[model samples]
Target: MNATVLKFGGSSFRHTEDYHRVAGHIADRLATGEGKIVAVVSAMSGITDNLKEVMLNVNKKASPSNVDAALATGEMISACCLEAAISRLRIPVMSLNGYSLGIRTNSDFGRASIESVDPKQIMAALLEHDVIVAAGAQAIDQSGRLTFLGRNSSDLTAIVIASMLGEHACEIYSDVPGVYTADPYLVPGAQLIPELAYQTILQMSLHGAKVLHHRGVHYAEKHRVSIICKSLTSDGAITGTIVSGHGNARSVTVARDSPVFSCASLEECDSLCALLARHDINVLRLEDSHGVRVCIVSDIDFAQRLVSLADIGPVFIGLSNVVTELDSSGLLVHLVGDYDGAISLVRQIHEQMYPAVVSVPFGASV
Candidate 1:
C-alpha cells in the first residue's frame, strides 16, 4: 500500500480561508491519483494557548493528567473541523483521534512517548476514506487512559505516524518557508536552506531552533524516515527543506551530543543514575565544576520524574536553545539559553548561538 503522511501546523488553520486552502491542497493531491494520504494536524492557531488558559483558570491545582486532557481538546477540535471542511468539498475523509487509531503511549501525562502503534486500524480506516485526519499529540496508555505528548509536539505525532506506516518520507507543512541558514527573526538577511542532514537538523532543534523539535527528528532518523518541511501558504514550486537520514556508520565514530541534567550533589547523582540504569537508561558525565555533578542523557523524562526527589537540588536541563533550571518544586526557576556576545550551550553540531550551517549548501545567500 503506497501512502504518504502530510502534517499541517497550527498556523495553517489560524483563519477561515486557511482551512479552505489546506483542504483544497489536499483535494488537489488526491485528484492526481496519488495513493492513500494520512494528514496529521495540530490545534488551530491560538487555540492551544486559549485552552491552556482555560485549564489554568478552572483549577490552579489541577493534576498534569487533567491539564493534558484539557489541552488535547484543541487538537481534537481542529481535526474534526478539518475533516468536516474536507468532507464538504465532496471528498471522503474522517477524523480519528490518536487513541482510536491504535496509538499507545507511556504513563507520562503531559509528555508521553509512543510505546507501540498498530497501523492495521489506520490502514483499514484509510481504505474506507481517501484521507484520514489524525488528531496529533494525544494518545492512550495500555490501561485505556488518555495521555499527551508535549507542547508543540504535533511534529512528533506526524513522524511517529509515518514511521508506523513504513513510509520513507513525510511532509511537514508550517508557516515558516523552510529551514534557514540562521533564525530569520534573530538575524536579518538570513536565507533558506533547501536540504539538511538528519544530525544537523537534530542539532538545530536541540540548540533552540523552533522549526523542528529534536524528538521528532530523532525518531525519524532512527527509523530511516525523511521529512520534508515546507510552507502551508506557498504557491508554484515546492521549495522546502529536506532532512535526509543516513544508515548506520560502520567506521564513523560520532561524538555523543545528547543533553544532560546536572544536579548539586554526588550521592544524589549516583542514585539517580543507578535507578535509571535499571530502565536501560545510561547517564554520562560531561562536565565537573566545584564538585557539581553533570550527566548527559537522551531525554528529559528523567528530570521530570526527579522533581519530587529531595536528593537532587536545582536540576538543570540543557537544551540546544536554552538551559532551564528546575527548582526543588519542579517549577522553572530560571531559563538561560542563547545569549548575545556570549557562548551558549555547546553541541557537537554547532558550538555557538549563531548556528553554523553545515547541513546544506547555501540556497539563498543574502
Candidate 2:
C-alpha cells in the first residue's frame, strides 16, 4: 500500500467538534483504502499561548530548560486528544512522542533541528496500527532534552516523517483554502495560484506571505517531497498550493551597480542576516563601509529586507539614485544590462518632468 502523511494545524483541531470532524475525515479516507496514513498534529488552538502565559507568571525570565518543559504540554495534549478521538473509530491507533520514538534533535530549546528519526520503530508501529498520531513541533535532543520545533514546526515534522517513510506526498491542512497571489483578506482581488515552483513559494513566504513556514518548505524541497496545502474542514477538492521542485524556466540575470542599502549596528545586521537566511536569500557580497555594513543581493530576493532595514535604521547613503519612494517595494529593478530602449523611455520621462532629469546610469534597467 502507498503511504501518506497528513498534518493538522492547531486551528483545525481546536475543539471537540473539530476533532470529530477530523476523525470523520480520516475514517472516510481509511475506508477508501487510499494508503497507509500517518497523522501529525499540533496543539489545539490557544493552548501554546496559555502554556506560555503560565511560564511567564511563574517566572518572567524562564530558562530554556523550563520553557521547553512547559511548551511541550501543548503537543502532548494534542496527541492525546487525537489518539482518543481516533480510538472511537476502533482503528488500531498509536500515539508516539518525540522522546519515546528517539527522534533526536539539537540542543536548541524553542527551535530545535531534527538530528535523526528512528524509522525502524516508527515503521513497525505504522505497520501494526491503522493510524499513528505523533506529536508535532516537539523533539528530543541528542542529550535527551525536550525541544520545541519553533512556530509552524508541525509542518516540518510532517515533512520529515513523510521523507523518512518515502511517501509520495505530504498534505498540510490549514485554515486557508490554498495559496493566493496575495493575502486574500488584504487584497480581495488576489487570485489563487494553482501551481508554483518551490523557489517562488520561498520568495513569496520571504516577502510577507504567511501560507507555509520557510523551514518546512526547505525540508520538503530538499527531500523531494511534494506538498499540498489544503483546508482541513472541507472535503472541498484538493484546493491549496502545491509546492514542487525547481523546473526549467527562462533564466534572466540583471547586474547592477546601484547603491546598496545596509544596516549599521552589528546586532541589527545579524538579525537582518538571519531574516534573509530564513527566506533563503543569497547575499552576493558584503562589505563594511565606515562601520556600516552593505550587503549586495546577487541572487535571491532582498527587496523586502531592504525596506525593513530602511525603516529600522541605515538610510541609503550611496551613489545610487534615491528612488526609495518607488512603488516597487519588495521588488528589485535590475539596473545593469543592455537597455537602450529603457534609456530612451527614461529620456521621455525626463522630457515630461523637468528638474528631475531621469539618469539612466549608462546600463541601468530598473
Which 10-residue window in model 1 sums to the lowest lDDT? 247-256
- Candidate 1, overall lDDT? 0.68
Q: Residue by residue across 1-366, what tens digits does model 1's lDDT show?
A: 578798988988888677778888888898888788899989998987788788889887678778888888888988888898899899999898856868898887767777888889888888899999999888888988778787678888889888888888988888776776455544443446677778766655554456776778888888988989888555622646888853211010111234446666676677667655554333444344535444443344434454444355546665422332211232111122334311222222132323453433333333
Candidate 2 clashing pairs?
none
- For model 2, residues 1-366, the per-residue Cα lDDT tens digits are 356789988878767778778877888888988566788988888888789889989997778767887888788888888888889989788888777655788775666677787777778887888888888888888778788877667888888889888885889888776676444543333445676677766655533356676677778888899889888645443666778974322111222233455666777666666665664454422453456554444222224434444436655544221111111133433232234543433333333433343333321334
Q: What are the runs in model 2 whose C-alpha is more than 4 Å off?
A: 234-237, 246-366
What's the residue-level lDDT of 8 in candidate 2? 89
Q: Per-model C-alpha lDDT, please?
A: 0.68, 0.65
TM-scores for every predicted model:
0.75, 0.70
Q: List candidate 1 segments past 4 Å from native.
A: 234-237, 246-263, 266-311, 315-366
